[model samples]
Target: MPPRPSTKKPNSNPLKKKGPENKFQRQQQPQQHSKEEETPFDNPTNTIPLSLQQLLLNVFQSALVPNTSTSQDGKQDASQRDAIEDEGQLDVKPLIQTIKSHLYNRDFDSAFTDANEELLRAYALRWSASRTLGYAGVFKAVLGILSGDKERRGAGGQIVCIGGGAGAEIVALAGVWRDIVALPTDDMNGEEGEGEGEGRMELKVTAVDIADWSGVIRRLDGAIRSSKVSGSKRHPAPLLPDGKRDKFSVTFQKADVLSLPEGELKSLYGQGTVMVTLMFTLNELFSTSMAKATAFLLRTTDVVEPGTLLLVVDSPGSYSSLSLGKSEEKVERKYPMKFLLDHTLLSVAEGKWEKVLSQDSRWWRRDAARLRYEVGEGAGLEDMRFQVHLYKRL
Candidate 1:
């Protein structure tokens, strides 16, 4: 009677209708949308779990994350988690089995190729960070020794570095030299004054190893360029009384620790102020003929004058088992740091070199739990401690 006004139903559009099927579809849509939006962590294509991802993320963040207020708690949390990850627990049998099977069944070459890439990647990451921090530690020690009144007396003067890889430590030490020698003590103390009458000392560095000559040269060139760009002052004019130009000079030679070149040794560093550093290279040197290796150690003292300073930094032998065991068949082996030190000290003593500093224990331990969490079971922690020895040629 009212012209069916209500029955016409406000001209409802079909699209706007809420039918049973529409309601059912609407209810299902959210679930489908959620599935499509899943994150890689949630649906990882590989066996790596979310917890492990968090752990790795924590490690990277801890190492590289710039310090900030919000990050303080994170840093602590990451450290604690890393400690747990370092423990010997947590099963990796399955992962190892998977890898072995893949290696044995598939083309062995491909499998090995992949594994090597992964290994290199891991080493590069860890070494880059550890080396940077470690170099900082070394430079701090050097400055402490250099700044002290005793060091300036030219008593116990040469610094020796073993196993100088990529020469990063050398670069860092050069920077320290620039900072110490270039800056007046007043500048170091955060105040400017009439520059002190202090003069810069001559630092003669010798880098020796069995690595490719080209690679070593490239690294040295880069380091020198970097030091120059950072505004390092060239050694002051008027050569020292010893007739040695007081410039930053480094001589690189290709010498195997096993059979060092005696002639080259005499020509490059025949008695002057020197400092020696040995890094991650001792193990390689040790595996060679012990007699030859011992001779090299003896020659270090022989080549330098009495009271030269020697600093040797190397990893403890514990971690060698992890990586070395895998490649043992291909490479010769040697004892850990303790044994190496015992032998080295005996050799040095026989060679008449006096030891100034010797620490057999390691200062840094790898977070085993974190490594296992990332690499899974077969992986173990490597102690990065060094038996630092400061020797005077005597």
Candidate 2:
């Protein structure tokens, strides 16, 4: 029995077959062959060049410059001030060339990294400036509230700053309050016979952001404390000749703009008149989902009392999309300025927020000029466009 030859024969084909030969299988084989013929670079990871990496790094380093103010005597010196003032004054040709070179060198990863840093820095600086201006305006409005004449102030107000990174914008707003509203009162000597400068004016500000970003938060906290200490030491006299101290209140808290906590909102605002600002932060929200972003805005608006103001400042350039490139072929797509504006405007409208004021594009160009180059030619002012909108609650 053991010596008997084995009866089993090896099967010629192990693969499943519908028939001896099927057209579908034959067709699939050629398609597979054609796919194999394609170059490895067709894969996304392989196609990205090394040059892009370097470009991204350079852009990011450029953005880190403004934060340097923290290390430099805690106050901007004349040179630093001049540089900041002239931010958007220079040509960005050098920056473009540097980025182009990095891309040509196939360092895409580095280029993207650097670009993200630069974008964050740019956003920080822009928010700082805009916050300063708006704060000044709001402070003036607050003064009107204190003024015996009713027409100057349009109801007492509260301000909520969203994505209030590092609190630079908030600090700047506080500075404006100290200067225009606080200092002026201190200058006036209290004397009933002299005149009626005898009352305190108060304004409240609340800053909110999603992440801890402890470094920024700490720096801001220190700056605020220092400002207050400096003001107290420098001005012993009351703002009003009547020996009254004008009160300016500021509260900083961690919060998620997408899903705001109701208790935090009530504590910060307390039914007082409100104004909201989403400075350079809407883009992050937009990146997640435009519909979701709009919903967040709508929800925020719904929570606030009627007649509140919402200020939105965002870059209107196809820069992000251009960087991401095309979806199908991985080719770069040049997005026109118009396309960016249309997209941003559509989002705002979708949120059901009506635009009260929209600034010209030149402001963004000015901001870009402020960017300084540490590694490569910095992005020029002309390469960017920003639109600021003030939407009043209906």
lDDT of each: 0.40, 0.40
List model 1 lDDT by residue over 199-230, tens digit each. Answer: 54556556664543333334333323321111
Worst 10 residues of 1 by lDDT: 1-10
* lDDT (Cα, 0-100) at 39 in candidate 1: 27
Q: Give per-residue CA lDDT, model 2, range 1-394, as digits (tens).
A: 0011223321111111222222233223211214544322112122212122111111222223422322112233232222121233322344445545665775543433335433334433333433333333333333322343343243445677777653544554554444344444322222123223232235566777664434434434333433112112233211111222235456667666666566665665567645777665665565544455656665666577665667665554313334344667576445443334334433533443444334323221122232232322432212223444455555
- In Å, residue 319's CA in model 2 sits off its true spot by 8.0
Quote each prediction's TM-score: 0.50, 0.47
Superposed by TM-score, candidate 1 places the C-alpha of residue 77 at a distance from the truth, in angstroms, of: 32
